[model samples]
Target: MKHYDYILVGAGLYSAVIAWHAKQAGKSCLVLERRSHIGGNIYCEEIEGINVHKYGAHIFHTSDRKVWDFVNSFVEFNRYTNSPVANYKGEIYNMPFNMNTFSRMWGISTPQEAKAIIDKQKSEITGEPKNLEEQAIALVGRDIYEKLVKGYTEKQWGRDCSELPSFIIKRLPVRFTYDNNYFNDLYQGIPIGGYNKLIDALFEGADIKTGVDFLAEKEKWMSMADKVVYTGAIDEYFEYCFGKLEYRTVRFETEVLDTDNYQGVAVVNYTDRETPYTRVIEHKHFEFGTQPKTVISKEYSTDWKEGMEPYYPVNNEKNQMLYQKYREKAQQQEKVFFGGRLGEYKYYDMDKVIASAMNGWEALHR
Candidate 1:
């Protein structure tokens, strides 16, 4: 019989932001999370004094100053820059395809020498690239594409480059500089005490319930609130009237190592076709931990089913069309509003999700 101004579903970044704004506006809000805990994929657990990124490695990087300021308000971020290395058959190279990588690969130092080498190799591709393989070759040439791109991309999508569409990799970033920083963002770092600090701060004024499936008892929850802000799968919200949308999920295999360091860097991508997992993440490196032991997670990409934890939205032609239909149906519902990665059927970074939720809150208030 308790009335609430808003019933926010999912308790992820999107829902947390909405609930925060709702509190600021003097509105009573309730957050219902299907999982046992909050923070969604960004949730971290402390093991051996190291915060393990449970789902996968989530590096918070954003060019937006507003979003940067917004998140920093909750928790202070450490000066952690993502400079991932690629291990191709025991040979290591820096990521973002920079001059350092070029130097290591072909003993070329200057940008001019690297450009010439790439340009020469790129010329091999004839007019109008058809597939991801051809498009990548056309962009950065065969050497970089073969060693760095092909296998990693193949593992991520669970498909070969030739079979996938060119639009999947519209542009392979080829940095001519010596910069190995993965992102060109103005603000980037991991939260000092892990992402849970931020999530806990965000949900301060909201009533939260975990291990509760909103869809199971939809009507009961819906009646308590004036409006429902759903951040779960859009198809699930509407009972998949237009069929299910496809997604690429990830499986994490985490281990506690006896040694201080497992991998020198935070992220090391295995760019070999034979490698089962795409990347190995050393969690301690993310926070500059000098612990006696370290925790690492090997990430494997998999096809998402109804019960699996959906990670990346496969925004291909068919899925997009189906999502559009669901979106239309969502808009027709007067009391329900959809947001976040799953609800929108789009891949969004953490910063973008926060900005989106803030925007959604503003729109709802207006």
Candidate 2:
């Protein structure tokens, strides 16, 4: 039997970063992936000479220099900015509620006109915002809320806007400028090739075993290392003794089109409730590919069930309290360290995941 310093439970970004840190510190690691591939949700599959984002659309955008420089060292990122368009019924508008969107909606120009319209409509919500509907109206006004926010959000959470909590729509981006660039980050781009290249680089020296379930042979795998870095669902790891944590998972329907330009943009969100899917992602636009064909994935947001792959945590009072119980139980265990979105039951963007793993690893050694 071969023993090592660490055995990572999942081959996602958190595990990959920890593995990278271990290699940097001259330690051996054995990485185990439940899936056949290594990159987890960030993993991409090549379809029609385009790197299709296997999960949903993921665009890297961050202002942190350390995390930015670290990933760039592995592969160069293209100048791909995320400026998604919203398709409501048959009409299309720019996302993030920018001036361009306002112009398209109201047939008016200048920030003054947009502000007047929004502020006038925002007056409808009196007192404290009671629910998502009120909160969204207070932020972006009734017209934008009805046409853009209400239907899409209802589909995403699988609930009426009035029934959902106000905290969910605490802030919706409304820019006065004409800039349609979705992110305000200093740097935003995709890797020169694809995300798989970055994952491969992060785990250059680690021994990886894909298509292996670590939890099935939990004891046997635990014996292979002094400590374990687990990136699976924390509630699942504990076997739901405290009941299952709720999540909002997405169902992807991806296909390759014979024509190159399908949507003419990377992301086009269907804001109308009539549409089954929330967004459609055209893979080739991320890299400015001139390939003869294009790949697209339609994302449908739904409530997560027992066996579905959990995409994001459903933030609410009930789930948070339940996660706290699992967290306290996890602290009692001496052998395993839990990290990542699912493990912690919290949403984390890409750069934040890398930064969190790096900080955790450094703190562990210190």
Provide TM-scores for the models: 0.99, 0.99
Instruction: State the C-alpha lDDT per candidate.
Output: 0.93, 0.93
Q: For all candidates, what are the clash counts?
A: 0, 0
What CA root-mean-square deviation does each model show from the true structure? 0.8, 0.8
TM-score of 1: 0.99
lDDT of 1 by residue, 195-261 (tens): 9999999999899999999999999999999999999999998898899999999998999999998
Give the distance in Å from residue 310's predicted Cα in candidate 1 to where it truly belongs. Answer: 0.6
* Per-residue lDDT value at 166 in model 2: 99
Off by over 4 Å in 2: none
lDDT of 1: 0.93
lDDT of 2 by residue, 51-124 (tens): 99999888999999999999999999999999999999989999989999999999999999999999999999
